[model samples]
Target: MQRLAGNLRTIDPEASESLRIVSYFDVLISRGASVDALLRGAAVMASAVVGATVRGRTIRRDADGRTPREETPTTSSRIDGGEWTAWIERPGVPAPLDDVILERLALGIALIESRRRLPGGVEVIIDAGMGEAERVAVLARMRIDPGALVRVIASPAGALSGADDAVILPTRRALVRVRLDRELVPPQKPGPWGLGTVVRADRAPESLETALIALRLTDERDRVVDASELGSFLLLARAFDPDHPPADVVALSALDERSRHVLRALAEAESMRSASAALGMHHSSVQARHEALTQTLGYDPRTPLGRARYVAAALLMRLAES
Candidate 1:
C-alpha cells in the first residue's frame, strides 16, 4: 500500500517519473515560480514521459497517494494508444519504525515466556529514587503484592526488623545506615540500574535489625515523622516474636534445632513471601510447617499473641540449651 520513503525497497524509474516531475515543480514553486506555470510544466513533463495522446489530469490525493484522472486520447497527439496515469504524494513524513518493531519484538518474547514462568510468583524490588506512587504503579502492573514488597535503604537501617512499629518516612532522600540482606534479593544484572527489586528488611535477621535501627535513628533525629516508624517497629517485634521463643513455652522434648531455625527465619523475615524465598520453598510449604510447629509448640505463628509466646519460649530454650 501506502507509499512511504522508508518502505521503498526498490524504485521503478518509469513508475517514479511522475514523482520526479512533482519534485521539480515543488523546487520551482519554492523559488517563486508561478503556480499556474508549475502546473503547466508538470503536465508537459507527464505527457512527454508517457505520451502526448495521454491527457494529464490531476486528481485529489487519496489515502494511498495522488490518484490520476482517466485519460482521453487527443487527436493531434504523438503517443501510444494506452492508458497511463501518474500518482504522487508527499515524501518526507517518517513513521516510528524502530520503536514499533522493537515493541512488537518485546511483546513476542513476553508472550512466549509468559507461559513458562510461575503464575505471578516472582518478587521484584526497585530501590530508592523510585517515587512511592510510581513504585506502586509499577508493582501493580507487575502483579506483585504491595504488602509483601519491601522498599528500604542500601544500608543496614533501611532493612526491616520484625518490628511493625518501625517507621518509613515520606522524604525522597536515600538512607545511609541500614542495609537489607542480599540473600533474599533478586538477582541484578550489571548495567545503569534505575530501579529493580533488591534487598529489603525481610531478607534476614540482620537485615531486619538494620531496618529497626534506621527507624530508631530517624526517630532520634526528628520527632515530626508519621506513624510509619512506630507501626513498623511494633509489627516487626510481633512478627519476629522477639520477647517469646518456642523453647521458653514448649517443653524441650517437643522441638529441635531445625524447627527453631525455621521459626527464627520466619520471625526475622519482614513478610511471609520473604521468609518463603529465604527458605527456598513455596509459601504454602512454609505455612504448613508453621502450622505443624504451632500444634507442637502450643501456639499459632500467624497470630501476634502466638508469636509473642513463641519468642518467649525460644529465648528460654536458648538459655536452657546454652
Candidate 2:
C-alpha cells in the first residue's frame, strides 16, 4: 500500500490519504483476491466503522480520520459526464447486518462509498480484484449487461478534490462506469451568458475542471452553462492580466451582436453547420462570420487550445465587469 501510494502520489501530488485507502483495495483486488474473500473482507471492514456516518453521502472515515473506500457521488461520479447508475440490491451475500450478527458472520464494509445513494438498490461493490469471468458472473447476477461498462480513472487524474472519471456505483464499485449516454455531457442549455466545451472523454478530469472553472466565473443561476459558449467575455478572460488592460479583448469588444452570436455558436458547436443551427442562421453566413472572427481574433476557435484561450479570455472579461 505504501509503495502504491508513493507511485500514485508521484502521478498526482495531491492524491489524498483517502485515495490511498481506496488504492489499497484496488491493489489487493488486482493481486488476485478471490470473490469470496473480497466479499468477506469488505463485510469485516464495515464492522470497523460501526456508528460512523460512513453510512451515507458523507465522507467515510474512522474516528482517527483514516479514510476507507471513500466515495463521494459527484466527488466520484459527476465528473465530466457519461455514467449510468442501477438501482439494485447489495452486491454481497444477502445477510442483513443483524442477520450477520445472528449468524456469527462478521459483516465488513465493502469499499463502495457508503454515501452515494443509488435509491432503488441495496448498495454493493465489485472489487477490481475479480477476473473477467468472475466480473461477468457477478454482473449477470446483478442483471447488468457486461458490454455497457466504461472504465473510470482510465484517464489521468485532474485537480479539484483529485477528480477523475471513476464511476461511483453501489455494487459495481470497481472504477468502471456504465454508459448512460455516449457523451458524458452536463445538461446543455445555451444562453448569452452560458459556457460549454467540447472535450475528449479520455480527458474527462481536465474537461470537468474546465467546465467547473467557467461555472465559477459566470453568474447565471437558471441556465446550465457550458464553458465554451459563454461568448466574448469568456474569451477575453483568458487574455486578461490583472496588472494590464486586456488588450486582446478590445478586438472582440467592437464586434456586432450578430458576430458575437456567431462566435458563441462557434465556441459551443463543432462546425460551421452546427454553429449555424445553434444560431438559427444560414450556414454560409455563419461560415463567413466564423472566418471573420478567426481573422479578427488572430486565432481559430475551431481548434481545442484556441477555443480554451478564447473561453479563458471570455471568462476574464466577465470577471472584469463583475
Candidate 3:
C-alpha cells in the first residue's frame, strides 16, 4: 500500500486509486484468491474509487479494508494525524422535492413512517398554495407514480418514511418524529408526506390532531381509523395539549391503579361484566370499583361525557411520554 501511494504521488488521485485497486486485485488473483475474495474486494475498490474521485481521498487501510471510520470537517493545511480523506456525502445527490405546485383533485389518508430506525426520511407540508398537477410532478421527481394520489411522496435526503402502506403526517416540527408499522391497511395515494395530528389530506387542522390521537390509541386492530370518524376525540385532541393536561387528568395520578384500570376498562368495554373480564377481574369487584371511581371522578368514566374526557386524558398521558 505504501509503495503504491509513493509511486502514484503525482497521478490523478481518482485514476491512481482505481489503478492501485486493479493491481491489488490482480496480485490477489495471481496468488490463488477465491471468486468471493475478488467480489468483496471489487465492491470496496469501487467505493474507494468514488471517494478518491470525488474528494481526492486516501483511505486508512487494515489487512482487510473499510474499517469503521468518521471524517471530521476541517480546514487545516497539515497532516497532523491519520488519514482523514473520506468524503461524507456524494456530489450529485439531488433534493427530493423543490417546491410543489398542487391541485385540488382528491384528498385522503396515507399513513407513513420510516422504514429504518433513522429519522428525516420524508417531509411534506400542505396548505392552500399548490395544486394537484404540480404535486404529481413533484412526486414524479421522486420516482413514485401512485395512480390516484393527489400529492407526491418526496423523500428528500431520505427525510420521509418509506413504508409503502403508511403515511407520516407531521405532528410536530420537520425532523423529530415516530415510526409505527402496520401490515393491515392498503396503500393510499402516493406523494410527499408530512406529520400533523389527525391524519388526512383535507384542510381541517383538527383532523391532523385527531390523526395523532388515533395513532396514540392504535393497537393490533386490523383497521386504522380516521380523525373524522373519531367524533369528539378530534375536538379533545385539538383542545388538549399533553403538557398541561386538564385538572381531572392531573388528579388521576392520586387515584389507585385498580380504580384507574377499572375506569379505563369500563370506559372502553360495552358492559361491566365484559370490562371486568377484559381487566381479568370479577364482575362484582369491577362493579364496586366502578361505583367508587364514579364518585371520585364526579362523573362515571363509563358515561358519555366522562368517557370522552377519560379517553382524552389517556391519550394525553401517552403523548406527553412519547
Query: Best candidate per TM-score, number?
Result: 3
Q: Candidate 1 vs. truth: CA RMSD?
A: 30.2
Clash count (model 1, backbone only): 56
In order of lDDT, best first, we have 2, 3, 1
Better of 1 and 3 by lDDT: 3
Indicate whether candidate 2 or candidate 3 has the larger TM-score.
Answer: 3
Model 1: weakest 10-residue lDDT segment is: 46-55
Q: How far is candidate 2 from the true structure (C-alpha RMSD, Å)?
A: 18.7
- Whole-model lDDT per candidate: 0.37, 0.41, 0.40
Candidate 1 residues lying further than 4 Å off, grouped into runs, are: 1-248
Cα lDDT tens digits, model 1, 126-208, are: 22222345445545565544555343332222343432323222111222222222334421422111111333222322233
User: In candidate 3, what are the lDDT values of residues 1-42, reduced to their tens digit?
Assistant: 657766785766654555554455444333323222222243
C-alpha TM-scores of all predictions: 0.23, 0.29, 0.41
